[model samples]
Target: MHASAQSQQHPVLDYAISHLTDLIAFDTTSKYSNLAIIEHLRSFFADLGADVSVLPNASGEKANLVARIGPADAPGIVLSGHTDVVPADPKQWQSNPFDMQKRGSRLFGRGTCDMKGFVACAMAAAPVFAEGKLKRPLYFCFSHDEEVGCLGAPAIAKYLASLDVPPELAIIGEPSEMQLINGQKGKIAMEVTVHGDGGHSSFSPQHVNAVEYASRIIAMIGERSKRYEREGPFDQDFSVPHATTLATIINGGVATNITPDACNFIFELRSIDQDAAQTDMQALIADVEAALLPEMQALAPKARIDWEEVFSYPAMGDATGCETFKKIEPILPARGGKVSYGSEGGVFEIYGGIPSVIIGPGSIRQAHKVDEFIEIEQLSQCLTFLDSLDTWMKR
Candidate 1:
């Protein structure tokens, strides 16, 4: 049905949609356990008779799966995708977010556009890869908690690094409307809680106001963001062309008449240079510890600030020059460049020492939004890429 805006109904497309339909049924939100979806993938890969390894995280609540088909001795390609999706609010959606709905050549579902579409395509092609006459192996790497902080990727990358011969490249399938992505910003998400001695409003000066200190810290981050915006060691390949710091959640004061005892806020920093960003954050902390903490401690001896890490992933450098890119360049739908958003592809490169690229079906504009969907044609295009990969492997 490639004519007149009709569905092509190819077997790969059909299989991918079938798998995607099942995958969307799973409520593998980042905050929830992803064991069920992990199990589904494990079973699927195991049934294919591939070399499948299910590596569970330390908490045993989530897991990552790596399945290798074809020749193992030779360096191969790794297809990576995340299983977790951001939580969906039913009230915000026109239909059930977890239930897959096919409408006018697009597949509607929560994870359909953000990821599962690519994962489904990858899995749908597993059988073909299994049976292909391959010179190099094809590896399928699926992980959990990717939506949260690339948490599942480290373990998968570690496992790949331990291989006799690591894969040649990692292609992360983050929704990019099928554009090739060579770079992305790294991220560190954290929560800061300021502790103080609460007292009546009359004694506010004597008591450390947690909300006041929290606001001060937020202001400091805002200043750093402004400085970066003004004097950026900029990367123009990204749409924003500059690093960013954002405080998304802040909670502090309980009552207007009383000084708050505690304040906590969650913030994130996205940068091209994560180490430098972290260094600056540490410097900010040192400045506060040296100056602000003592001032608060003068009034409340037990006053302190606590910093806890929520999640973190490294930024990937440009990989457009990698030999592997040349192998698949001819099939690229759009030009390659950097993206403002982050992906596990960065960790696959930085943590696992695998060169990486990002290209996949669907627009990011559809991801994490109400009525998320991926164009069915994109899945068809992805199938062509996967099949062409087999063609290259055989050559």
Candidate 2:
């Protein structure tokens, strides 16, 4: 039945929509501090009698929130989502990006689908899991800066691991259209800056051109990506089917008449196997420094290249066998699937020692779009699924 139609009997759906409305009002873009939204969530959960903790970054600008309901000594499932979102240009949107607008069956807003929708559902269900009779704990894991990189999840994972009764498994709510996501590729993101000297265009030969060297590195990355696509070390489960690397952003040069002084570029590798991918990344960086440094140094002794790690999240292997996964088997999708997108699941497993599954409301296609939205039907679907989860926990 439709979400609006089901709302009369489904108070959870009503509460979810109410929570989502308030959540979307926060401008939690990655570029800005998300402390406001984090505080809001903290208060909400604390008021409901759940144990809530806020882990802040060194700067105290961003934070990850963990909320627990039930006995502290019992293992439980984690409900995860990111609080931050990509920037939304007001010009591209029909209404204010922070204002949730109901249009037909969809709720339009910047983070309505990318995340906060699932967060709303989890929050709405908090009371259910907090009842005195709850057998095990229910943990809500929310992080910041996921749009930039999964910068906050590691802290949450580590914190969970440090607990006496850590989470056994996690449900990463990342706009999966309520389907079970068994696996996903990991990501390795890096930023490389080439330093050189600027000079007149006519004297380019005498001065090292940073842009030119950056292009060489980009070309090398392209060649490696091509080889991976053409060769056999592939996993047919992922849509891309192979490790892929590419330069996503680059900045260099000034006037057309002047040789650039410096160039900065960013690149990433999305891989089915993180070990192999990391190895390839290290080799690629080494080759660039070896091959291009000499040429640039020959012209200018001070010329050099620097590389910095942006951020990365591990790839999730199939989660069908996870202990917590089996509990919700009745509601899981009949068949499993893998995605090229990276998520906190892998890090939760590797870092927190928790197995994980990815499932949530809304399609990823709605994420980060001009008029981002989540279907009301999907909201109902998530509530129904959560009911099944509650039953499992009660049993």
Candidate 3:
């Protein structure tokens, strides 16, 4: 028998998998609007008798959906996910990525794993949670723009932070093949642009090579990376226990005969510490600009070297003794290790004071891939996990 058969089966989860095909049909690509899906969820939750709150983004094009089931006074768990899927090109996929198709044990689509699967499973369980005579509460939080540096969740988290009945814990249902994810690496994305005087290639000495100068800045970051690796404070569970990565996107240089006047590069670092991230970035950029810009401006005197912070997601630490962690361990096989990927869990940890953990069906490997899929067997296991959750709550 399927493990879900061990307890009273939740009809809500069954409903979720069936409706997931419909949800996946809409192209909620990160760059586009998710209004159709958001509206559908709003209606579905409201019909379930949940008090739904839809928070709109600046453009009013996308929204974050928050639904509560149970008494306001009771502390509860928030089941979190994003409504956006990364863009998928038809030519890159073997099947229609927007259309959910089922083969033996697998459902294939654009977002079958990178996370609509968890959202579907959570939605399937919602009705059951709503009907139960509960001691605690359950909150469903679906956000937009998670693919874009977790931009959508901050508003929702801020709203929750303002509430008198803030959630006690948050379970960010990012795919982890059912393991509990307790840690994440921090991230800092920046774009560095170098402006130098333009001159003829014959007079190349009179103008600075912006691309060359950008390479020097990139090199500076690389030197810092080595130091971050040997003498840093990262947990060993990570594949690389260090502040890793310095990627530069090279753009500019019109003709080989002309000295390139402007070059811009975008780079990022994934780390375990914020202060270390900032300190390394500031020091490296300061030194590189101090060394390079003066020589460039000697030709134009209007040369510039500057950077902008695009976005930042904090690193997560292990959550060994937290109430949220305690709630989920009994249902999972065993405690799992840290993952390098970033999630909205970091925001919940810092802003909501609600201990958060990432756990759900599917694998990170399959997430956001061309032929993305989740095993029906995994869905069955998730249903069983939810059953365990019901039993645990009852106890």
Candidate 4:
């Protein structure tokens, strides 16, 4: 439908759009501080007589905002979204990525689809929740640095666990086109550094080549990736439906004529079978330590291989028959499925023991794209879902 027609159908849609425009104005890129946006949300919820708390990171430059409406003593639903967005280059976008622009039926902005659309809808519905006689509380959890590997969420989850009564269920608004997402693969990122002896290209065989060893590791990882694709114990709900490993970044060699002294590469495993993935990773490391290390050390005694874990988040398993699933199923349009992307939902579930699901407006495809946008109708539908949630909590 046309923008004018849709906007007229639901006045709340306009409210959501207005709030979205304001939110998009803040350039909360992961590299930049998100304190301004967190403070804005804190004041917005505080003005509505809700209890608000800002949990700042160690540097105090960024923070996570947790706001609650209705009875704080009772367990209730938590609407969670990240405040930080992936970096967007203005040269690639049609307009300023931080400025919300409406064209036809879509609203374009950096975080419009990746998340802020859902956050805007939640903000627009805050008053409705505050005014309603809710038997249970409604929480708003806005986190920072999610684009940089879900860094802020673990702290938020820990804080929630310390509460007298933590939330019963958490709904992560992570651009699932408003469909419920019940499961996602776990991810572990690591950087492998290989130390070797540097020598002239003319006498390469006399010294260990770090780049050659790095290539061997990459090839081993690729072979394991192929095995995962062919193995059993796969979940068909996910798009890929299997545990996978990939090497994302590789760097070695300073000059064409010199053998590199060190090689570094980053790789990750997205796995449905965390146990198997961990076992495989340990085996790979053991192999390097036992075999590769000896060969390299013979040439250079200090030659070694080291690994640094960069980031990791647990997986969300199927929640079809879970209590939280039963509670939220009626409000959802269809049965929940799995998503390939990672979010804080798994952290909430595994760390805080809070049942979690992902559902929100906009399409995941638009996230991190050149000109990300959310359909006007998607925001309107999300409003309806919030209204239903309000009524459900009252019951």
lDDT of each: 0.86, 0.88, 0.80, 0.88
What ranking of all candidate models by lDDT puts the best one first? 4, 2, 1, 3
* The 10-residue segment with the lowest total lDDT in model 2: 327-336
Tens-digit per-residue lDDT, 12-74, candidate 4: 888899999999999999999998899899999999999998999999998999998989788
> Residue 111 of candidate 2: its Cα lDDT?
95
- lDDT tens digits, residues 310-355, model 1? 8888998777788877876775556657888889988888778898
- lDDT by residue (145-212, candidate 3, tens digit) is 88878889888888887777788778788888887777778788888898877778899888788877
Better candidate number, 3 or 4, judged by lDDT:
4
Candidate that would win on TM-score: 4
Candidate 4 collision pairs: none
User: TM-score of each candidate?
Assistant: 0.93, 0.94, 0.92, 0.96
Badly placed stretches (over 4 Å) of model 1 are 1-11, 289-291
lDDT of 4 at 324: 63
Clashes of 4: 0
Candidate ordering by TM-score (highest first): 4, 2, 1, 3
RMSD of each: 2.2, 2.0, 2.8, 1.6
Residue 68, model 3: lDDT of: 85
